[model samples]
Target chain A: MTQSLPSASGTPNPCIELSNVSKSYGLVPALSNLSFAIPEGGRYALLGPNGAGKSTTLKLLIGSLRPDSGRVSILGSPPDSRAAKAEVGYLPEDALPYRMLSVRENLEYIGSLRAVGDLKNRVDYLLDALDLREYERSNVGRLSRGNTQKLAIALAIVHSPKVLLLDEPLNYLDIPTQEKVIAMLESLQGTHLVSTHIMSIAGRLTDSVVMISKGTILWKGAIDELKRMGSPDEPIEKIVARMMTGAI
Target chain B: MLFRVLKFVLRTRFSRPFLGFILLMIFYSIVISRAIPPTGISVIISYYIVGIVAFFLAMSLATGGVMVMKSDRDFLFTLPLSSRDLSIAIFFSQFIAYGVTVLLLFAYLSQAFSSALLLVDLVALALTLTSLGTIAPSMTTKGRVSASVLLALWTSSALLKFPFTPGSAFSGSVVYGTATLVVLAAATVTIAFRNLPHVELDMVKSMVRSSSSEIKAPNSYVGKSPVSAIYFMNLSNMSLAGRFNMAGTARYVSKRVKSTWVAAIASAGAAAYVAFILIAYGAVHFSAAPLPAQIIANVILGFLAFAFSQSAITYERIWLSLTSLPPATYFRNLIAAKVLSLMLILAPFAVADAALAYLGYAGALASMVVVAVVIPGFFVLEVCWAAFTAPIQVKGDDMLMPAQFNLRQMAAAVPLVAVMGIAASASGVLDIALIGGLAIWVVSASLAVSGGFWNSVVSRLTESGFV
Candidate 1:
């Protein structure tokens, strides 16, 4: 994968940033003063257990939900702002596409909305890369969970957005397709924050990891540094579990 | 034991609301009965018999299918009870619910019933309830196709009435009703014992197949053009399109007016041609031409315009998928789209009327003016009513599920219809100019009210987490 310098040092500043953002539903807090930042061209993983605010964080970044306190900015503006949304692409957890639409129709429809350049060619490339060539005419409702995930991923990246927020991007995929998707996502030139529990997915798709628990950040650093914290030959999954549940 | 079963039934979240709603309906019927004369004794008896029969038929159709075909059947069949015991339990539970409803209705309309008739009613209700419970399990199957076939058979049997009328066929009633109830009960018990296990296994297999298949990769396709620019524009307009664009507004208004003009013109042209034929042929005495004919033309034009206005907004439910979009964007586009669509649907008819007037069809021209001037006003009133009172969710089978309606929502629709009717009536006595001026005022007022209504409703729905 090609490497690019962190854009935060430049005059335009970072592509996405969150400073102590907190959100809650009634008595249950979803995100508790969680903070993170991704500069332009940064590839990072957001690792946490279920209900650890992984989905909530992505929703905040995508402007689907507003933070109860603190701040979240995308490309230096509020997440839903035209300029911010224009540069951002998001795939929600268990993302559901328009069920009535066929695969090709969904791609083209979203492409038109985003005003992507050479829409047809871009859609074709994504379709082939994702290996969704045979069920193009099928309604999305009829597609399997794995295929639905593929279509959702395609939709998120259709605009070739500058800031991408993906929740469980490789969910429901077989091992081989997961590998293919990691490579495909790595090839894109943009800032990416992928939320997942799988350490291997984090390691392959991103260089850095941000571990969170109980809606707060537990650790943030390189994947290599996280591995070094564990004893030699210790599985990364155990390490992640320890960090998430605060066992260590 | 009965109370325990009732408690179990009520414990289900769906059942409580359903039962409560039915009770409320029964209460409302009682209130209405006080105002109208009590239906005669014969009619009351007939009503009870029909209600009992319908209740049994409903139970047999709904529960029988669920018992035989559903996965829940396994749990039910495995319970420590004999088939006869289970059938009796099911029968009484359904019977009690139906019986209570009838008792409430009779209490409210007490003046209509005699002691002998009430006894017969009770007997019929008991027989029907038990019969349905017995029959339901036999007719239903695990598969949808089989269930449908069973339903068709049940429906045909219910519709096939006996030769004796309610009061006339005493002997036939006794024989037919008793035979129907006994046969249904026997068939249900037989079927319940035989089909229960096979259906349970089939259900398990189907569930497993569905879940396993959900993880497979879908086949893809290539070489298709993207969706049209217009489709995207419509989607954006419905979902994310910001406050009004001047270009979009002008295009919409022009389109609306052009179509309405076309309709108006077409009506006028047809009317003028008929008038010319009447004049040329001297088919009838001119003095004999009824004045009501002119009024009829005016009413037709008025109704056409009213239809145009109502349909403009109603069409959005199907054409635009507004329900899924962001509320502010959806409302804005809805207002603009309806305004345009109405103009398109009604403007031609108005223009056609004016053209015919120019061609010496005075009556037709007059009707066209009534439509042109009255329609837009009606459109605004209807739109406002719909904006405030029309339920946000589209009517479908799912909507039939329990829902609450507020008093304010129920009242919101009243004024729109009333005001339009009053305005149309007033148009008859007032000078044409005065009526026209009033029409414009009503339309403008309705439009403003509608805009505010949309904003309030949208905000509330969003805040409530309904959308």
Candidate 2:
């Protein structure tokens, strides 16, 4: 559901905001003073190549990782604050559900923990939607990788979180499931940031694009603006490659 | 190419150190064996039986090792090599690892026997056993099952040594010798070649493919659980305790049931063994005082408590998602759940001890107190130490360095040790100390449960790039 509008400040207070946030690991910086905003109900893609701070950025937003410097606020609350977390739903990179738990049990356990409203119904809906109904009773360890990933996704969205941060949300999905998941994501309205390397995923899941390279923000604008940066005949993938490599 | 592979395998830190250590141990054992005078036929027969048993044990371990090797077989198989080449490479590679260990044992036996015939027998036996080891992993697709079966067989054979030996046969006389060696070697080579063709490189690619499937969708859960708030707050400094969401919490509770049941069975089995040992000792020495017996019982119980406590936190490593929750909430839940589980495991023994005490059995009351009070105290102490010291990481599988050998961990362990020690010493009044100590621990733990500690840990984790 779309979030209610904030008080009139003309400066639309974003549900999620990063101001000059930088994070470094030893000698290598993963995120370099990168700043961006996802307004309440705004769907944005944090597009980048491998090691472009996409996962790192999502981690910061979800309070899984702290910025080395600068501020990260989720819904105007500190990332580590309970209020911020309560409003957020995060699907980590390579989301791993408890292996020993059955698919149904995994859903029930996480659903109950999230204090999900009508948890059984929610879990059932996810199972049906993800086509995990057949494997519902099977242990996650025994289930194929695709099934496990499906369960992980179901766990992430079971509660219907507000400020959602997803990293490469459709990595292992078949083409049909990908379309279904894309459709499912498109139907949801909230402050969202999806980090992905795929331009097509970015186009399907988000309206605005935030392109980052070597831990720094290279560009931030509408998807149309990103497309406009390329020649009329150019594929968006080539344009993104040029931007990422600093050739354009 | 073969030399390069051999050099790489030999040069590994584990390989080099392992080889050196085995050689040193062999030299020491041989020197010790030589100092003792042999008792002729009986000694020779004993040595022969021991050698055979050792060979079997080595074979079982090698089989398990082959399974470990097979788990990573796809990586080696992908190097543009033929199946025969791969099989030979594996045979040589394993020969280096297991061969070094077997050779050390052989060298030790050679010193004792001092016969060229005995030395030849030992070397041939080790090589045959080592070859037989490769058969299990080569035949089975499931490494864990094969390894477990081999381990069980090895353990049973070791345990049943008396029944297997031919009482009158001398060491040099051959019964079923050369034929056994030939069969073992032939089987090993046959299995290796049979399985080599089926070793698929796609295993590695499939493994990777399966792992990378789940990607989080943006804006999925916007409003959900209150616990998610706690999970988010402590996300960076993901404590093991904090990871407990509803599903995790349920699993945590269920785990307690499984662990407690296992512990109860183990405790019962141990109690029976200890009874047997005590009975055997009493039979041998009828005049021994009850005080010495009590002391021995206390020491064994003390060791059991400490060992059990040490592993309690480590066991929870599998349920790492609980780290996503807040530390305070998670720790409290975990400690409470574990305490309940510990009580369940210890309850039967506590009852048995109490019954014995009622019947005026020697030191029964004290034993009961040790089992009930000191054991649970140790459990609490371990949980606390694990919570404060070994904070969980988000990735779950992050290799935890010994939490920088800080004064806090040492200081925490001291009181835990001291309390358990005192309880063991006090005996019947152990319950009072357990209750008092737990209250004190809970209060002390509260003081260290600030958000600052968690924040600093989270920041350190973030810096380390683990989250």
> DockQ scores for all the models shown?
0.17, 0.18
Model 2 chain A TM-score equals 0.94
Query: How high is the TM-score of chain A in each model?
Result: 0.92, 0.94
Over the stretch B357-429, how does candidate 2's per-residue lDDT look in tens digits? 5645555566677666666666666555544464333232222212122334323345555655655554544
Docking class of 1: incorrect
| Stretches of model 2 off by over 4 angstroms after superposition | A1-8, B8-75, B82-85, B88-133, B138-264, B267-271, B274-324, B335-467
Q: RMSD (Cα, Å) of candidate 1?
A: 11.9
Q: What's the C-alpha lDDT at position A46 in model 2?
A: 89
Which regions of candidate 1 are displaced past 4 Å? Answer: A1-12, B1-19, B22-37, B41-327, B330-467
Taking the tens digit of each residue's C-alpha lDDT, what string does model 1 give over A116-150?
Answer: 77877898888999998776776565688898889
- Write one digit per residue (lDDT tens) for candidate 1, span B363-397: 44445545555555655665556544543331111
Per-residue error (Å), model 1, residue B451 = 11
lDDT of 2 by residue, A36-150 (tens): 8777888898888788888778767767567879999887887766666566777766676754346776676666555678877888899999999988777464676677678
